[model samples]
Target chain A: MKHIKVFKTTMIASVVMSGLSVSSASQAANWLMLQGTEPAAAAGRAKVWGFIQAQYQKDQSDAGPTPSGEGYIPPKLIGPNLNSQQQFNVNRARLGVRGIGMPLDSRVNYFLLAEFGNNGITAPGGGDAHLTDASITINTDATRIRAGLFKIPGPEETLQAIHVFDYINFSEVSNQLMLERFPQSVDTFQGATDTPDASMGQYSRALGAVRDVGVQLFDSFQSADWDHSYAVMLGNGNGLNFGDNDDNLDTYLYWSSEMQFGGKGPRAEGLKLFAWNHSGKRTNAYNKTQEQDRKRSGVGVKYLQKPFRATFEYMQGDGMIFQGQHRPTMVFNDEEADGYYVDFGYYIPNTNWELDLRIDSYTRGENFIHPVNATLNSAASDESTFDKTTIGAQYHINKKTRINMEYSDRSFESDTATVNAQLEGVGARMAVQLTHIF
Target chain B: MKKFLMIMACLLSFSIQASPDSKPFAEKRIVLQISDPDPFKQTLVLNVANNLINHYGQDKVDIEIVAFGPGLRLLFRENANVDRIDGLTNSGVQFSACENTIKGMTKQLGHAPQLNPSAVHVSAGVVRIIDLVGEGYQLIKP
Candidate 1:
């Protein structure tokens, strides 16, 4: 243990030294700085921008029978009420206006965006319009303070501007862990039976979209050629809700150091090292008196230079894990979970084409009991593992538009053999999406 | 811990100062600002610089182009006008890149953008232009 601690210290020291040594007077910029701060030269009072993603996805596997031979469940997308084998949908339709204060005050800027899509952000609430980002930032020499509804500083995949996301779908780990889903209850035994209705207790509101109402203090500084940034935010633990559910607030801490390679805009080339931690408490929707601890943390490195780009991240969670529907019920447990993902892409030189590959794995519900049947009073300690490998390609039609095609091979495992058999023959999925930014 | 502090000190020592002092001997001093992201505008500014050099003679005139905001793209390492920038530098023309713009871009792009090696750092392009104008240099926003 002593040696391990020393080794960890040395590694951290080395990373810090490397970041400091590469410092110079000039280099790159960061996404958060660009979005939160206004440029000195003001063009207008408000500038509008947004993107739209139209997608078509199909499940490649055939419907298979469960181990019990009672019924058949078709392979579906990794979301609630999306059991269809094929569908075409506008995954995202977002529009917003952002700019400095009227009459040209660069120190104060605001960002406002709304979602008009048929995805989780709108579908769960059965609403056509949903506000995703509405924040005002006050800039000072030392730091910037932003308040309102905004994204939580978390994983790169979650924190970075979504319009430039290279993949059609998020990695499994990010989907299950970071892309939060708020259910009304944690009582798995409330309607427990031998065969519960699969859709009875599912989440009706797919809110959160990774945003919270809060205030954050963040800034980035340059040292030689490296740019280091830090953000500390205090937020209402409730996701996207205007009011806090409990007295306790969520605290988020994030730090990143990057070495610039060149380029500009969302696709710039750089090497970044980042880590973040999020801790909060969630009150059970059904049992208001009961609250569960929710904590998540991650560390990662991302490198992007011209033709080659790669990112790897490892994440861990303790308490309040979102276990997907066990046939007829959604389960939330105070259990431990961990996940990781590695993504690599290559942009063909002098061409508007890029190829991408990503692999991700997640394990949830460690040593947690699930009622097999309430009538028999039988329970089992259930655990599940999910893995996915996605191969994709992007064809850039122009600077503001691109088409992406992806094929994903997915697999699921459970400690219960019967559950494993039910998830067998889970096959590949194909998706094609076109995105245009204005 | 001691060794780590020593290395940090060494790194800090290499920090370069922003903006160079004015040249006193030059007959004419001019500062040009490029604040737009249009590629055509970028090329036009370079053309204007070339015209000024041709008319005044390279040694007789001092020219500096200060870029900020969207116009910072002109100083990008991969910019198409890299050859022109190199030619202008050889003709004694100076290029100044704004740190504010870099910071803004860094915040947006998630990293500091690589700039042309010939470009000198300035805390802010607008301030740099103001300083140059105060130093008897004519300011042009073309």
Candidate 2:
């Protein structure tokens, strides 16, 4: 930490000295960060930023082996921890950074970014960190073109900011989306049991991966009464930071359009439609077994009427294979899964407090392919569903940070095994995260 | 060419209406304006424009948006549709940049925002609002 501070000061001094002799034009022209900020940079140029979040989660129920991954068969696909003493544990402390460059002439040109869950979301060493998003933009009026590791939406899920969701983990449907973002979130990946294969547990961020990275072009259309914007991207099939394996590259599309509905006020009134899509890829396991091409898709809607904002989205991946007695890549017939979520929040017009609620539901495709529990069995119909609900509030300390608290209620139902695995469980996600936008 | 010619005709006719001699208030309607330093809000404003363009036709209605403060960005000079500014501006899309905010805000951001001289430079956010309202621009903060 001390070394970084010294390094920052030195770099600034060199630039400041160089800038000292130059005219205000050059000084103003040479963008540097607002010197006092942590994400060091120049003025006139966009700034860079990053953050760290610490969180904890507990499953109120004891997990048994099942199609999804772990836990005893609950009456539903998602439910509370059944036995506190044997409950599973989830904890996270993560950090990331953002880099915006100094502006040049005629343009307030700069980069926008974020990263956490280790350089890679699924990288080894188990630190929940990742290079979330990094993109550059050339601005002009209400229109601009952005390129770099950017966001592509198919679902309401945050493609570049996955960890911000109120729930500690993503829904099942979100996990299956294009390139199987964060496979661990669906089930143990190991069809074998509710308990993870201790050897590889260190590799995956129990929360999983984010699928946004690629070059995108964006622009806006505006009028006195309303405004609209759109973005399109081409990226790695395996979400951001997943790196290239043999997996093929894919294309993504995102469009957010809206209008001022019945408005005659001091505030703008409107409703919007935001949708996104990605090319899905099959793992080596599924490819060897099935020749079918699978894909991921998502749609979301947002409406803002003064102090109220409501958003709902559904996203899904066509084919995936979790870990199993076979191999981690083995594909089974009809093995595809997806999920949906609806979230709404209200904040007093001029206050920092917001009331929020979200409902998420999903199914593990393979939950129908096999069963857990060495003895008693359940039917496939009984094991495929999983879902959860969360109602919460957030207090914004300021523009760059906020603290959130929520109550989570969940349940799951399985057929083939006595106890369903990961998808069905009741739990609480207690977390605190810091965020900043540059 | 026909569509282009038609759009051109519509643009020319609309400009004539903003003239004080030809007030557009003969119809029961209103105009709105947005000016914010926010990127999200700027994007939203554009969408609103699209909605108005589609529903009201660029020619039939009187619409104008005045931007200032850090808001000068919405119309970055090099934006791909740099020409869109002219298309909107010529058709009565009044753009205003805050001279005071521009002086200090640009210093903070590192450089001055790319702006066309054609954009009106107001001395302050408050004054800009008052001036536009005085000109009968409906006030809307989206």
Candidate 3:
């Protein structure tokens, strides 16, 4: 009788274990929510992670002549000293630590990352290391609050996880318009006589790298089959510096809705629609007493599914615009500009190969104020349109490593025939990079 | 008394054979092991399991995913793949969470970690794999 009772008890235990069930809750996929966040249940004191990108890039454009017999300088890769046609570089090497306040309180988490690469983040200042992200987030039932130096909510290209970026270089629009470059000194040089013996020199202090010191409130939620996210941030207009340049603070707003397709992680499969705007005031270094309005806004759509991917983005800028350098002259002033890009990709079935193509165009200086003969003059610049088409291929060596190869066909345009002819020398570029995440 | 003892032995053996939570007529059994922390690997393991189910009818095959070490992150309640886990659960796939890892994490975390409802606690991930293998299941480390 005792043995029979034991048998019945064992059967009951088995039945109870097999019948276990729990209530289900809905979940959403938001990179912002997933990237730096630790799971509430397994929140650790410290977790370290990072990635490295090594690359070689070459500019194929050749110097040519303008109609006036003046030499036309072809574009060069932007780097230290800024004149290399081809070179090998450790483009990005970053390490970061992230964790929640475990035994104390899981609601608070922190993320800190540093850059040790030969790129804009460090090279501009000749520094060996640059702190890119240092932020702390507090989670609540309603929303999450993050504070410190971090990437502002804006373009998908800038907001997404950089380690998984599909391309080695950013689009022309994102590069020139979004990536803030700070000038070391004001440009006092006018035309010929007043031109400083030395050029303003490559932005000597810092590169924004699409980051700002700010405080943001953000969250993500699921409704039906879609995951929606939103963020509002207030930041110092200055790039990497912790302090604001002017009394005016930058305001950023972003929203995204993604239709989840049953995948996870940074490269999840989804169709996302997003829009964002950033507005701020910059204290002009050239005219210290004067503050210029800076505004940027964008809208885009991205889709990722098995064997196919597509992205399209359109951006606009008003007021302060970076005009880059012309000989020893540095230009930054109020201007109007716009740009757009379309990218498509295909993954070969049963293979590790993926092919991609992208077309991008940008028109700058719609209302450019030219510095001529030691005086500021209003002019409609004819040489302002830039376009490029990029063909790329990626080979996934393993889950954490991949090789990327790309060739870009570049071109320039102007209303003046001679200016257009002079820009014809602008040519193609090729780059190859290997990325590993650990 | 000898006859009664024999009958008890037979019944115990039969109960042990029927105790597995798998479909009665499953033609194939697979146990997938995930021991890496990489999110890509975690997602790939699920993809492999889905592909297997697509190839073999869900009723014809039984699948169990065993996670240990850092791979336990995949079974966290707030994991990014919560929807995928729910879908797979409804499809009859099972997820086994290693209790050993949970205890280690608890020590480091100062509190016990919460797991997805779909994940069933197992004494150890490797031992679970071994038990499944002993039951004629194929082992795949994806």
Candidate 4:
């Protein structure tokens, strides 16, 4: 309570000081409607934009050293701790600047952005600022070429800004397949019937930084009623701000089109269809450092109408992260996985209130491979699947401030003898968040 | 905890000192962009203009509205929002209509099209915006 009061006081004081400054400035300037506080600058001049997201998450999963006399321990996925724990965090603190160069030809524009927030949402480590975007665009009226660190052409949901996401947490499929980080604790499974090699755990690495260092060429084909666009990129497979970690480069391609159903401008409404391909390579087996193939493809649809919106996406991939689990001494084998999600949202006719729902699921099609010398039998035909459903509501206090509340139910099931010992369970979580844009 | 507090103090100081709002100048200049073909969006642009004029007063702020492509229709003589446009113009807001769009529309209609009398024809809407921004005019695409 005391902390909350302190935070509120500080925030109010800042806004008051800012208001005084804006009201007293004597210069002739254009005022930004949404970003009203920005200092006036010319069209070709660079300007800064950013937002902050702070949140609290509570997990209701009954996960501990072991589950109610179960013979083995299940891998932790929902919370950062080895056991379910609640947390308060600054999820994303981002800052960015973009504009056409003031002196250079108007055709040339540049953007650079960075995040000083939590590194791993469900884990430890990462209290440093990291670059998220650094791109230069040379564009004509309809076509453009962009090079540097940017988002890979993939799922539209992955490409959307986190501040705009309707749900507190992303769909299960996006979390497991796209972010790709696996649980790291071997301590919880120490007494299990089949012990994993604790020293070989891959917990040090996190997957699914959506953006990569890349170059993309994109253009649009437009008519009075529709807009069609396409983009292709080649990038270093490694996530944000880093050079390629492997010898092979990654490739991404996307195509999309929107057909207007409503009149033009803010009232213009449309339905869109999009498809993308992601192909890359990843290193497997920590000791041997063997190179392996990674491929993914997806298709989705989106509908944008005033006060209502909906999106659906499906994706499949085959990679070295055996059966979607990264563990110490895990075998390096080809595994295929697929997932999909449906999201729907609506806003109250004349209020700041909004309602939303989402369903997400993922299936791993390969066997939960076991260590070669394990004491328990490796059930080769067993498979695992995950599902999650979320119901949420949001209220826009104004254009720049918002509050969100969400409830989610998640379930995991597997048929393998090794995992059935402790893996099959259901968990529920509730979260609330506050977002401010500047 | 101490380190966190120190960081927050530094950030707040920087936020205040680095505010882009403190440039030494004689006047405030603003540009409004209407690139969407929707009349509803154009009205929103006008609303923003009115709000700014109300807050800063018409005499203190320099305002311009730039339109092109499908957005050019916002300045058509028969536009649904012509009265709103004229009202804003009366308060010193300038409107720039893109000649490139006018030419395209004229070719499509097989005759030269007419724009609202309040609009000043420009070679290109985007170029006008670029030039204005270079002169330190902040853009507000409401």
- What DockQ, on C-alphas, does every prediction get? 0.07, 0.02, 0.13, 0.03
Q: What is candidate 2's lDDT per residue for A85-120, written digit by digit as tens? A: 222222222333333343224333444443443232
* lDDT score for residue A245 of model 3: 69
TM-score of each: 0.72, 0.56, 0.73, 0.65
Candidate 1's residue-wise lDDT over A1-438, tens digit each? Answer: 554565576567555533422322222446666666654323235788899999898876543345352222323443334545577888799999987554123457899999998776777646788888899998775688999999998899988888788898888788878877677653233221223223322456656888899999998777656789888999997787777877989999999899877765567778999999999988777777878889999999999997999999999998777665332133345777899999999999999999999999998873323355333221345677889999999999999999999999989766754445545656788999999999
Ranking by TM-score: 3, 1, 4, 2
Q: What local lDDT score does residue A50 receive in model 4, on the 0 to 100 scale?
A: 86
| Chain A TM-score of candidate 2 vs. true chain A | 0.65
Give stretches of model 2 more than 4 Å off: A1-43, A64-102, A105-130, A137-147, A159-172, A175-208, A241-243, A260-269, A283-292, A321-334, A348-351, A367-383, A418-438, B1-115, B118-142
Docking class for model 4 is incorrect
Which regions of candidate 3 are displaced past 4 Å?
A: A1-29, A67-74, A78-80, A103-105, A186-201, A325-331, A366-378, A381-383, A415-422, B1-142
What does candidate 4's lDDT look like per residue over A312-351, in tens digits? 9998888744443334334244667889999888988989
Which portions of model 1 show Cα errors greater than 4 Å?
A1-29, A69-75, A78-81, A185-201, A325-331, A366-381, B1-142
lDDT of 3 by residue, A237-277 (tens): 78788887678899999999998896666778889999999
User: RMSD of model 2, in Å?
Assistant: 15.3
Residue A72 shift from truth in candidate 1, angstroms: 6.7
Q: Which residue segments of model 4 deviate by more than 4 Å?
A: A1-44, A64-84, A121-127, A181-202, A261-269, A285-289, A321-332, A366-378, B1-142
Q: Which of the two, 2 or 3, has more TM-score?
A: 3
Candidate 2, residue A12: Cα displacement in angstroms equals: 44
Error of 3 at B7 (Å): 36
In the range B1-142, model 1's lDDT, one tens digit per residue, is: 6566556545533332222343445688899999885446787899999999999887778899999988887776545466677789778788889999999888776677766666778899999998988878899988
Better of 3 and 4 by DockQ: 3
Candidate 1: DockQ? Answer: 0.07
